[model samples]
Target: MTIKIAQISCGTEYSGIQSEIENAAATVGGKMVYPDVSYEEITRAVDDFGFDPVSPQLKLMIARAKALADGHYDADAVFIASCFRCAEGALVRNEVRRYLQEHARLPVVTYSFTERLKAAQLLTRMEALVTIVAKKELLARERQVGLTAGIDSGSSTTKAMILRDNEIIGKSWTPTGEVIGSAQEVLDEALEEAGVKFNDLEGIGVTGYGRFLIGRKLDANLIQEELTTNSKGAVWLADRQRGEATIIDIGGMDNKAITVRDGIPDNFTMGGICAGASGRFLEMVSKRLRVEITELGALADKGDWSKVNMNSYCSVFGIQDLVTSLAAGHTIEDVAAAACHSVAEQVYEQQLQEIDVRRPIIQVGGTSLISGLVTAVGEMVGSEPIVPENSQYIGAAGGALLSSGFLEGQ
Candidate 1:
């Protein structure tokens, strides 16, 4: 089925990224349609929304959202977007998102775009939105019922997990090299550890940056983007699938903040302004400090962040600050602590603002294994985050869990 995703935005034509957005949706079996509204309806919608914007384009955007909410148009999902350069456009964009989420109850993804936006940049978000609308029942399944294997081919690392009847029996994590090679290596290792041959697996799922390439190579049953998979894995791991929760995944190249209800994502945001706020920054800190990345977490736990002034938003400048702190005779522990704190603070400032953060914030992804980073996130969020067992394998676990729904006779 071709899911119809409604496009609500302003300046896409002027910005020249409209086709890119449509291409992204179409790449995942979705058709982007605009909600038709008359000028009289636009005027009425502006009054009903109670926020009048000066621009006529903004007025039309409001009317389109209203039309969708009022069932004047048929749509399986909503994509709200606006040029990042416009402050007023952003306000209208967010308000429209919240309004439709409350009234229309459809899957929505919002984007702040630049003229440089490309179809590749929007593919993951579009794919996830399509998956939510098309595979609603698959996402709702709570448990793994058969032997399944999952591979997460991430930017920095590749991980694989094998699950049997709701239990993770084996897994492997390794630095990512050639996408397919890394995925194959981990799958072999995980199968070895699980003492199961490939023929025994009932289903196989794949996710992360290299999902499409590796998924095709492996003939995956479920080739999904990480946003939906991660949330599914997170709630399942944290045992919070039955209620409202927030999921934070501070990944290698980017970050994701998701607000989910009953294990399914209603709204989510991904990407960061810089690598300084991501796990890649911490890896540089570890290299500079001459300690293993795993050891940096323990060292950071013993130090004080206040002792060092490493407050650069760019990863390159952040590393320069790290070197400066070290040259200034600051302890390595303090520098590690400062690095962790900086990333946590940036995540809060950049991505957390995009969603209504519900309680029991579950932090997942490889970064969740860093005790210092996890602690810093807890301090920033005003509550300790729940990092579940096998948290580092969230993407893999999510794939395995979701793929189980495709098992024979399931």
Candidate 2:
């Protein structure tokens, strides 16, 4: 179904990009719907919708007031058209935005007809806004069918997962950049892969370092702590509803240790002092060694990590140690394994201080994809750690599950 955008303006003059905006919306399978309501009609709508006029001077305010008053708009998004040097727009845009944000909750895009307004730029902006609105509308439809999405907007990567009936049908990850854009990218990719529409999702949950930003931008229904979500996710993925387990989640910027007891997150610790145990450290080492991150784990599995002892506690010093080892005739595999061991060792010495090693240990997060790192952590914790599928997406999956009420009251 095509998304419909409500075009609203403050002044009597047209913005002169009506055709361009309409074409751009059409390009993205959307329609531009202009409500031809007069001032009297809007006043009557305010009376009907029961919203008192905030200011009679602000024409845009009246239009939004009327829309809210009537409680009816055929559009999924709202576009504010204004001309340059319009004092009315400047005076009322903020309050108008607040009203729309509070009441309508629909995506709002503004177009200012400045003297330098290029056609290409206008079209691009229109297309982008239309695309965002389309996704929102599609997700609204998906909500009717028991679907939800979770986004883990981590410092390193943005991950998205689509859940239906408490099961993840689609998941995707991309490097985190321009938070809002990446959030959309990951969601779009995941939804497309699942062959689902945006409206299919009943809700959206966000977690991770960038969770707050993405949550606000996406209007997420659930914004959870990474530690809590990861703990819930690890237990869920491991299928361990009862009993204690220690979870090691090493991400790009930080390494987290979550202790789950009887399916509840009891205690958690995050490492911030050193980067040697984090994914960023591994990425740097991989680049220095000219080794692909994906290939490092397999190679490390075969090498003798004990031979290349990495004693550096900091990431900077760790790199120096690795380079020195290479200069001293150590092989790449040995260095890679040593790097993985260094991360595990840091977790044990720093991040895992309060956690019990006697219980089952679950290694998760993007770093868990490295088998050698998983092996190293298992060895340190004295038990073979369980590495669940889509370990990188565990937080997002947990958020999705929480939104679906699958992890509620647990």
Winner by TM-score? 1
Q: How do the residues 1-410 of candidate 2 rate in per-residue lDDT, one tens digit apiece?
A: 87877766554234455566666667656687775567787676546544444545455455654574356545666666556566556435444544564566555555445544444444433443454454332222211125878899898899999987757788899999988899899999999998998876777878876777888987777776676667667777777657778788998987777666655543455655467778998898889999888888988898788999797588889999999999999999999999989888888976675344437788889989989889888888778888988888988877776665522333
User: Which sections of candidate 1 miss by over 4 Å?
Assistant: 408-410
**Which model scores highest in lDDT?**
1
- For candidate 1, lDDT tens digit of each residue in 308-355? 998859999999999999999999999999999999999997788767
Candidate 1 TM-score, C-alpha based: 0.97
Worst 10 residues of 1 by lDDT: 349-358
- lDDT score for residue 374 of model 2: 90
Off by over 4 Å in 2: 1-145, 406-410
